[model samples]
Target: MSEPTPTTCMRCAVGCGHLQSGREDGHGVAEAKGNPEHPTNEGADCQRGIEETVDPGGDRLTQPLVRRGGELQPTNWDTAVGVVANRFIEALSNGGGDIAVLGSGQQTTEAVYALGKLARGGFGTRYYDANTRLCMASAVKAYDSAFGSDAPPPTYDDIPKADTHLVWGANPKTAHPVLYRWIAESAAAKDSQLVVVDPVETQTAADADIHIQPAPGTDLA
Candidate 1:
């Protein structure tokens, strides 16, 4: 193994520090371990991180492909980029009103910032949005209506101080294992009441003191 390099895992919004060791030839990652000094996870890593390092599945696309005559063919980087650029130019020349850019929440902050700059400054279009908007738009609207601002008041550190915790429409056990572990530990230590509101009985709901399964669309009601 090569020398371990400290880096941050980008699988989710919650950044976790890790040490990645590459192969001796430095081609790919060989092993990964959580950084003990990191406040977020403190030497605890989820299955996602381990899978990313050791068991990267074989279904990845290494090169760009373009469709020609109803058949996809491998193409070089320049050709692929030219195709995308031409399409963007054509779309902008026709009309910028209907053209919109959608970004993923899983992307790095730098990637998202660059995309925003490209959409707003380069293309001069206000039709750009991220996947986060799909999930948080309702909550943000409610917060804005109630408090005149969209900023949330609570942080992850506030979880331990609460006497009761309620989770809704999220399965943190699979989505955020490290955070779920922390919540479980806190609940066990404090004997706090845990309530889960979900349409289905998830692993998190199984651990909760009370699981309320309301109708799917009636959550807001």
Candidate 2:
């Protein structure tokens, strides 16, 4: 293959850049590589990015499906579209135009934007939010309150330089092995302490300088 388009993974806050290669159908194979230009990654990829790849699945549909006679099958896209369209139309016609849409982190920015527009413009709904509201809402609130926004204070390089490294809540050995390597290597560099805190003991916990296993529901304590 020749060269591939460079882009970042939107899956997480790490936002590691990736190299995508394949045909023009948009379902391209991807891999995580170093992004020399990216200030944070600077040519490194965590496990999440390394294992990421193109979806072998074909183009997806937003249309609804109906089940008839114990079998689920595709109905007329137009009728399905019209059902939603008429529902929204009736909702607006009835002056009950409060609509809301749940967006997603996995979707590209354009898809999210279109969904937002559909809610606000098409349905006149102002209550649109992504499912991340449940996943990262608290973290966002705390980070914004402390750091003034979603800005990440530490880059991937900064992990190696921290004298005190704490691995809490998340087990990076299985979740993000490449990033966990940085922590392990940094701890081995002398004078740096690496601590693992979780409810369950994992491979990473076994290798930590200190492992604290809190009893089940007492993780927050």
Candidate 3:
């Protein structure tokens, strides 16, 4: 085995830090462990984040492939980027009516900032948007209205310090395992309250001090 490569888990937005100890059996990953020093997860990880069964090249793109001639062919990053730039220029020349810049949740804060700048400053397009808006529009609007930002009210460090955790419509056990670890610990150690609001009895709800199971679509009532 070689030195474990420290990396972040991109399985979810929690972005837990972990170490990837290279595979030994060629069939499965030999070891995947969390970083003890990481402030976000604190040596904790979930099943999906730690235990992954990836068959080599199993529907995963290893390199950039651009359609040349009639099919996608492997190309260098410079060529691929150049091709995309040319396409963007051509589209802009055509009045940019067909141009739209979309960002994803996976992108870092710096990346999204650059993307927004590129869309508004470089491309001069008003059609740019983040994909999260389509799914979490109401939540984003509420956050912006209340806090003047779409980011979460509390940071990852603040979760454990909170006296009462009100988890609404989100199952941290699956979608955010790292967060669940802190919530569960805080509830156990500090005797903090964990209130889960969901229509289903999710794993997160099971660990809650109060599980509010309202009728689906009737939560406000």
The residue-by-residue lDDT of candidate 2 on 1-221, one tens digit each, is 43666877654555666665654544456434656676555677764565545543456664467566887678888877776677778777765356667887777777878887877877777678885585578878878887897755677878878987888888877776656777888988888888889888888888888898898898874
**Candidate 2: count of backbone clashes, pairs at least 3 residues apart or interchain:** 2
Q: Name model 2 segments beyond 4 Å from true.
A: 1-3, 10-12, 24-52, 56-72, 75-90, 95-98, 108-114, 141-157, 214-218
Global lDDT of model 3: 0.79
What are the per-model C-alpha RMSD values against the true structure? 3.7, 4.5, 4.5
Q: Give the number of the best model, judged by TM-score.
A: 1
Instruction: List TM-score per model, in order.
Output: 0.74, 0.68, 0.70
What tens digits encode model 3's per-residue C-alpha lDDT throughout 1-221?
Answer: 55677778756677888877666654345677888878887788877776552223357776789997899999999999999999999989977766899898767677889998988888878888885576579878989998999977788778678889888888987777777888888877666799999998899999899999999898764
After TM-score superposition, what is the CA distance of residue 86 in candidate 2 from its true location, in Å? 4.8
- Name the TM-score of candidate 3: 0.70
Q: What is the lDDT of residue 172 in candidate 2?
A: 78
- Candidate 2, residue 27: lDDT: 44
lDDT of 3 at 31: 73
- Angstrom error at residue 13, model 1: 3.4
Model 1 lDDT tens row, 1-221: 98878888866666788888898865678898898888888989988977776667778776899999999899999999999898889878966655689998777778989998988877777899986587679979888887788967666788788778888889998899988877887776656988899988899999998999998888876
As for candidate 1, its clashing pairs are none
> Candidate 3: where is the Cα deviation over 4 Å?
1-7, 20-32, 51-58, 62-82, 92-98, 145-149, 215-217
